[model samples]
Target: MKCFQLVRSVLDEIYSEIPLQDEAQKDKAIKDEILSLRSKYAKLLSSSRVIDYENPITRFSYIYSYVTSHANIVYNIIESSDMLCALMDSKKVSMTSIGGGPGSDLLGVIKYLTNASKSPTLRCNLYDRESAWGESWSDVDNKLENPFKISIYFQQFDVGEPSTWVRHVKYLSSDLFTMVYFMSEVFGNKTTAEPFFNNLFANAKKGALFLYADNNTPDFYNWFDELAHRNSLITIESTSKNFNVNYDEEKTDLGIYYDKFGFPKLTANIAYRICQKQ
Candidate 1:
């Protein structure tokens, strides 16, 4: 029920599937992967490069390093947003997550619903460019002891390609839409990403709620506001703040890897917005 539960599940998947010669190798492998990824992200603040996700090592490395903090940041944003909370009042609610491969977006929402003890039936659709990430999170709902009826579906979505996203219309029905750290991820390819957002906002149903949480940078947050403005989405709240990963020590479950890599991202500097389609 807690978000850490989801974090443990990711670690479990990595331990089970990734092949290593020995415990020492795992320590080296995970540590090396994390450092390489860490360096890439650090430089990404200034430039853009498409990260390869086909490698299992790369994907798992991302899971170990970023998902935890991103999920927590999302939980903090929704916990403070009354508009997102209102969706829980419905008997059945749906959400669509753009670039949700890391599983942070849904895990964050799951954590909130558990903490609130609200058990409305929830449907989740994750749209991302990588089909490989689909399997990484396929067993999540099964692993977590969800109090509510929950179902998830993954669709291959390329933000730079309109051919892929245009075919998918079911997402338009979602009561909520999440773009957690997604804009920043695709910030380099804004030329193509913009059309995708344009079509999405122009067609999304009136009254649909949107949550945008990402880096506290002008390129990221400013791009979000421009699309919202073009679409006429009513802004509920928009601000940039610092958030720490509020984790329970008892729930921590990384075994040897914990000692190898000190911890995943424990804090984030974010600019977030809660809006309603009008």
Candidate 2:
């Protein structure tokens, strides 16, 4: 199967396992949780409390709506960037995605590598507080015919509690690091997050690549830029773009939620930066 199709299939299988309830009741619950998550997501960088994804439905809703939407846009952004092209050309690449749940960043990297006809052995580590996501994503990974010889390791680390984030130290010094829709989630606690990011930059191999993609907001981008400057990471390229994404009705479960919730074709206002630790 094609890469995109595989993503859809994997998600379908995972969602299928979720026990069925009244369709209307389930939709309402999912919608309510989605709205709550959206509100919490916007304030994440500033909020002192951690946003919960412990609920299975909340996790599923996130993957169904937010994760899939951002993944599509992120895939497009990576595909169009020359900097990423050069980085992915290496024979072997190590990558880590902070707050990477259920493999959105992984899928994007896989898409790019497959399209470029580059079969690099990818060692990917996904860090998130939600350990359940690791199981769901691993199921998907096991079902795929991996062209890149990708191996994924999931680390259950809470970005909100940097004091307990020691597990990630061994995974530093990677060739690439991705923060797709992630900084905004933890930016509210910049004081707590700074040390982790600083340590990451300090330990990253020289010339290691960093990809930051998120909602195109001045405050968010400014925050990331500040971090880059503080760590002496050099910005290679930065750009913002607006694009519309349409969901496939039959190919993915995402369409079911979109239709139930009356979600429009997503207009993604996204900003991305490629930097290298100097």
Clashes of each: 0, 3
lDDT of 1 at 144: 65
Please, what are the lDDT tens digits per residue for candidate 1 over residues 180-202? 98888888778888989988888
Q: Which pairs in model 1 have colliding backbones?
A: none
Q: What RMSD does model 1 have?
A: 1.7
Model 2 misplacement above 4 A: 1-7, 13-24, 246-265
The digit string of per-residue lDDT tens for model 2 on 81-195 reads: 7877877778888999888876778877776676668788888899887887887666555666655487888888876576658655677778889999888877777787888
lDDT of 2 at 24: 72
lDDT per model vs. reference? 0.81, 0.73
Worst 10 residues of 2 by lDDT: 246-255
State every prediction's TM-score relative to the real structure. Answer: 0.94, 0.86
